[model samples]
Target: MSSTPESKPSALNPDNKKAPVTNSMPEHISLDKWADTGYEWAGEVEPSSFQRLATVLSTDHEQTKTQLDANLYRRNNVLHLAFTLTGNVWLTCQRCLQPVAIDLSDDYDIALLENESQVRLVNEEQDYLLLDEIITEQSPERLLPFKKLVEDEILLKTPMAPKHDDCEMTVEQFGEIPEEEESENPFAALASLKGKL
Candidate 1:
């Protein structure tokens, strides 16, 4: 919670006993006293808390890559996080329904609420969280939905599958459908009764 530079990370030593940072983009960052320092997203996350690595692969297809212009600051008891994420991603193609390469970039400005159970509900009229400087007895209960944002950004930028102008599957692959069989009209039997009326 102190603003001293020593409290900030400078460079990550793999041998250092701390969280394993997954990304290499912030290599010069130093984690002095955070647990499992590398991969863990807990504690006072500083700009240098991350590594200088380019990619942080959380899964086979899901990752956080590129430079992070992010910082964690606390004014009073409230925390504020601001950052921008830009990177290339692989997402499902919208057209062919296949994996497609995509470019993603997103900017975020989040006010960290201090309460353990702050209401996540937001006003529909405003685009920002309308809460004041709330004192939190615990770590923030809510954070900007990061994964969802990345997924949405990727989905928005994804191209239709088989993005090439000409796909391999040709028109011939679509076979023609047979015509429908004709059936006798049910009204035909009622024609005789109409004449009698």
Candidate 2:
């Protein structure tokens, strides 16, 4: 496998200018205004920190496309993000190195912590966080890292190389070796001795 670095944790920082961007996604849309309004975010999930967890499944002829389905619930200053993801992706087969299509469907359950004093801290110890109330400052974008997770799962499922189950080696593939020359038993003299007995 190629050693090109997968996106790093620092690359996820929305403020990181060093992150390489091949595709352009509009700067994150804020969740603050949509919080109490009972609106859901539905659009093309891009190559952001959260979206990186979810691999967009597609073919060479298609682009990365995704749909975000979620219910936003707020109570006692907590925001609950609940959603599902559906998409397809093309991955190299481990065995034959051929392109294979992998489909994905995922459910997301996340909560954001909130406090009034405008205090925001990322506790690596926790899986979720407090949501932001405004778009002015850099807030962690509420994207689910579906792609990366999917890629990992696929890696565990795929074989080292892909081949048809019924495939057999052709004569040309066997090359010039004769069947007698390929025999494993070198003790032909023992067989002759048994015949003399």
C-alpha root-mean-square deviation, each candidate: 11.8, 12.8
Worst 10-residue lDDT window for candidate 2 reads 1-10
**lDDT of all the models against the reference?**
0.39, 0.42
Candidate 2's TM-score: 0.42
Best by TM-score: 2
Please state the error at residue 196 of candidate 1 in Å: 3.6
TM per candidate: 0.38, 0.42
Deviation (Å) of 115 in candidate 2: 8.5
Q: Which sections of candidate 1 miss by over 4 Å?
A: 1-23, 26-67, 100-103, 112-178
Separate clash counts for every candidate: 24, 23
For model 2, the local distance difference test gives: 0.42
lDDT by residue (tens digit), candidate 1, 76-137: 33444444556655544445544444554576555545453433433233123323332212
Find the candidate with the highest lDDT and give its number. Answer: 2
